[model samples]
Target: MMDALERVTGPANATPGAASSAIAPVLAGPPQPVRVLAAFPAAVYLEHATGLLAVVAADGVQHPNAVVLSVGVAARPLAGLHVGQEGTVGDGAIGVGQLQVTVARWFDPSPHLRATSPPLIAGKIADARAHLMARTGSDSHDLAVPADAVAEALRSGDMDGVLTAVRDLVGAGPGLTPAGDDVLAGLFAAVVTLSPAVAPEATTTLTRTLALTGGAVVDRARHVTTAVSAELLHHAVRGEVADLAAAVLHAFTGRRPLTPALDALLAVGATSGRDLAHGLITGAALVLATAEAGDPDRPATTVGAR
Candidate 1:
């Protein structure tokens, strides 16, 4: 993406140069010429899946919603675009108001998945869980009961019970998005990966649940976020917990961590990280149990000190 941006800006013009003589400045004080390098018609959606304001073109190309032109906090150039405005973004003299895309300020959802000491990750998860339990009105128990039920249902290959358990848990917690939705996201991600037979009904139920609680705004956001999470969770279950760590991170921090994903999750809200961590752990455990129960001949994969 940087390479594409550089090609448009050119190497010599990467940094801000003097105002061009050809064009006059839009502002009164400084006569600066800002040239539009690249522009596209994009449907700006706050992807609740990863918490990014995805700017995808009609043809299905994703553009970087935020771009930094120079160094320091004052050099933010793309901060002035609006959701429904046809504006120019380019290399040249820019004013703060004209360039400010207030919505872009929220598009930092990427997961930081790095190789780390498994013990460190485990410890962080434990701390997150404890913190969540102590919070006022925390719904960990409310969420956990259905999770356990789902796991037990998966163990017995009881598809009916599994669907029922999942339905009971959907829209189960507080908040606009709800902790239950996050758990369902994690649980469904794992189930679809390990137990394909149950994926169809499980996904349908989850979609209905999201629609019921999310309303128009959240329902629209889920279109992107839920899909991205599912793919990441698939990658996670196939390998180590590290693979899905980004999925857990995206549930809270919005942006993926550049360091360890666990560190990102543990550093977030009063109980947001804790709740996501709980869902992730539960999803992973349920996947393992389902795999073991479904195929007794296949050796079970062990994770961490357990």
Candidate 2:
């Protein structure tokens, strides 16, 4: 039987303060996390390549929203089964404290996935490219050089080289969370989907790269990009062909503005939306470039190749 742990709505030590002007707006949205607590037991399942999907029980009750955990690693033993779990908050355990949560649902294809098709994917790629071209004149594109270098390093199995290229790309874009980081995150996700076997090593390199490029700003961008990219990659891993394609496609084509998932990424910062859009386009370009190169062990083609 699962252990019954008491659920504290917020931090055990927290007292509800009278709403004040300064703190009101920050608290306007969904509830925020409080104190750090012990790791409570949870039920874990694989959300395909997305990462761990965990339903932790608080007071032995299930939560409607399962926490989607993203770790850049290959498949684990829990790939398709439900099992008891416990882990640190930094690893994607969501709660105020050591709140126990139970899995309410896992990987339900978003309704948005239905709109995807090959032509849509192709069209979005074209549209995103055109958008970049229009934005910067002549389609020279954003992050083209570094993205290509990272892809080449991946194909060549040079994890260190990949890390260097990623750091350089992410370090230089505009905004608090440079747009390049988001695109790099997307590119990372695509590579993970196209080659699941490489994730463990790739993740190792990525973790180290992020460490070397440390800063409060970059860290924030990393957090948002990692989450967004993991979701996209997980959809691809599950063969949710339409939804996976739709996520990026919509970001570029915009028949619909931003999907709920993407919107969350955007809300991370002031310029997150614009940066994410640029990232999506650039990420797609990287994927197209690699796919067209036709060699898993060679440098990726340039965005202009197609």
Candidate 3:
């Protein structure tokens, strides 16, 4: 090896005793895709006989086990290694080793995954509904309405019933202000779009559920918000809605009301929501904007229609 000065110094400035020495490492082949586990702290090797080692080596989450092959980790991906191939994902590995044990670490589930515990008052969905209901008592008969009635209103197309029942539950006391703006934001979750004519019913179910579940409402809301937001960012702006966004919209709006949002959606010039479901989210946003624009009594779909 060259001396310290010879290595650090430029080739031209090499000392008389030391020969000019400057070497750089060469890059290997093209980048290869490596499988990574996101759930746990460490990665479980994709043992062939053993199957997908735990995606996450360690985690509170109950780990899903993989199937084992006869020989061992397949020489290459052999014997249909798709069974236990799910979990969080991260970067690829550097070099290759026998398909014995792969390594992995926990992929941070931040903005992607909603926080489960200590729900965000506004940021989380389920919690917002509860908060909103708590502030606004049920509007049904003074007698506590049966859960069946609540479920029925939601399950059947009883928008008016749901609104009236929930109104009774909330009672004449004070209004149930959602804990924060998060409540509205969280509405993105557990929401399905309906035909424009049926939007009132969808919102009715939505408001009722929020008041009832208390805790679950916020959690679900977070999930909805995240799912919908992601879809919008990727697909809607481009054009069509992504799978998740489409699903959420369908679920939240129901059949009757989403028609206008759908019409609005088809009208815009954009690509598909493959990257993100931006279009569907746009439809949802328009719903809110329309609601805010006027007629607290009027449904969001009516504005889109106009």
lDDT of 1 by residue, 1-306 (tens): 333222332124233322211111121122222333223333233322222222232222112222222233334333444434443323322322244221111112222334332233334445444454554345255677777776566545565566566666555556433566556555544443323322233234333332233233233334433433332232222321222344553332223432255445545445445555566656545444433434456554332112
Give all TM-scores, in the order shown. Answer: 0.41, 0.41, 0.20
**Pairs with backbone N, CA or C atoms under 3 Å apart (clashes), candidate 2:** 55-101, 55-102, 55-103, 56-101, 56-102, 57-100, 57-101, 57-102, 58-100
Off by over 4 Å in 3: 1-81, 84-279, 293-306
Better of 2 and 3 by lDDT: 2
Q: Residue 288 of candidate 1: its Cα lDDT?
A: 45
Worst 10 residues of 2 by lDDT: 16-25
Tell me the whole-model lDDT of each prediction, alpha carbons only: 0.38, 0.38, 0.27
lDDT tens readout by residue for model 2, 265-299: 43444544445445445445544454444545656
Off by over 4 Å in 1: 1-78, 81-140, 153-163, 172-176, 190-244, 247-261, 294-306
* Candidate 3 lDDT trough over 10 residues, lowest sum: 18-27
Cα displacement (angstroms), candidate 2, residue 272, comes to 2.5
lDDT of 1: 0.38
| Number of the candidate with higher TM-score, 2 or 3 | 2
TM for candidate 3 is 0.20
